[model samples]
Structures are given as C-alpha cells and as structure tokens.
Target: MNSKIPKSIDEYIKNFPNEVQQILQTIRSTIQKEVPEATETISYAMPTFVLNGTLVHFAAYAKHIGFYALPSGNIAFQKEISKYKFGKGSIQFPLNEPIPYGLIKKIVKFRVNENLEKTKKRIQKKKSKPNHE
Candidate 1:
C-alpha cells in the first residue's frame, strides 16, 4: 500500500478525509467505550485494540472500513456479521452503507469478556500445576 503506516490510532484516522475520519473515530470510540481498559496501538498498519490479547483492529480503505475482530469474534457473531462482505476474520463496511455501530459495540464487549475469561482460565491452570524444580 502506498499509504503511510500510522504509529497510532489517532495518526491513522488523521490521514483520512473528514467523513472517513468521523467513521473511524466512531469505531474507535465504540471499542473504547466497550473496553475502557484495552490498550490502543497500531498493528499491521491499522488501529488495534488489545486486552488480554488483540480485541479488534480497524483500517480505513479507499472504499470501505475494514473491521477485524479475529476468527473467534467472527464465528460468534456470524449470523449478524454475514450481511456485510467479509473474509476469514474481517468485515468490510462500505463507506456508502450504514455502519452498524451497535453491533460493533456488542462484538467488542463480547471480545473483552472472552479475553478476560480466557486469561482467568490460564491463570487457574497455571496455579493448579505443580512446580518443576
């Protein structure tokens, strides 16, 4: 891609036009509101939200906004997300189409809870294991 890779979500959204920036910000804020503790960073040249692991990623394209919630998130919300164009783990919300912010919030919240549960399970598993000196 000829576009410059942004170092942060703010920088990434700043590169886009005003309308695109609004969409990107709304997506960012929705995710943030869902997981207030999640860290914001740039990964794969896109805006990435990280909790116990990667919660989600989003990028603005020429024609669409690419929202990635990983395979688990996609699988969990397959029925609702299937309406949009998608790949293995990502969905493309067209610029002209209405972006489903409510659905996105639900997905992000689900991911946050999922990640937290997984982290707790891992911790419990480790606690159960005997020390090997």
Candidate 2:
C-alpha cells in the first residue's frame, strides 16, 4: 500500500500492480453496474461508493481484496460470504482464487436498496414530525 492516502478511486487503483489493478477495476465496475447512481471516492484508504450513504467499499491487499459492504450486507449473504475470509463487516477475496464478481454484484445491489430504504424511512419520519415553531 502507498504511504500517501489516495484522493480518488482511480489513484487508488493505480497504486497496485497490473494483475491487481484489473481485479480492482472489475470489482469497481461490478459495484457501478449494481448502483450506477452511487458516487465514487476514497474512504478509509479504499474505494467507496456513496448514495444516501455508503453502498460498498473495496481495496486490493497483498494476498486478498478487502470488501466492506457494511455488516448488514454481509449478514444478508452469509452463505455466499462464508467461503471467504471475513470479519464482522469485511470480507476478503483471496488474490489466488477466482474472485466472485457475481456475488459482489448482488451484495452491492442489496446495499443500495438498504440505504435507499433507510433514507426513505428517515424522510417519512421527518415529514410526519409535528412542527414546534
């Protein structure tokens, strides 16, 4: 990993080798395909997509690609993610093995819907609130 933090997703991907760059690009495009409206930026030194909130994040590591789809997203696809190395909210797709782009797409789509629903609920709550003034 580079010492200076990346300012953008393209800069972050350029920091890696050709093989890793391709993998990162595919993952980025997969997330984009799932949530084309999501904005891309660098968050926590990784590539992150933000809509109403963060839709998903991914970074290339020495041995694996670290993916953060939020805890709920991981819980939602426990069976599929169980095959990878995972923690509370993050999953690692090993560089050696074939990356599951399809699963990544699904998880991203789930996260997009989750965030959108939460945003909608928050708006509804605000609209229903009684004005104090």
Candidate 2 residue runs with Cα over 4 Å from true position: none
For model 1, state the Cα shift of residue 68 in Å. Answer: 0.3
TM-score for each model: 0.95, 0.97
Tens-place lDDT per residue, model 2, 25-120, is: 999988888788889999988899999998888989899999998899999999999989899899999999999999998898898889989999
Which prediction has the highest TM-score against the true structure? 2
- What's the lDDT for all of these models? 0.91, 0.92
Q: How many backbone clashes does candidate 2 have?
A: 0
Which window of ten consecutive residues has the lowest lDDT sum in model 2? 29-38
For residue 87, model 2's alpha carbon misses the true position, in angstroms, by 0.6
Give lDDT tens digits, candidate 1, residues 1-133. 3477878888888888999999999999989888888999999999999999999999888999999989888999999998899988899999999999999999898889999999999999999999999
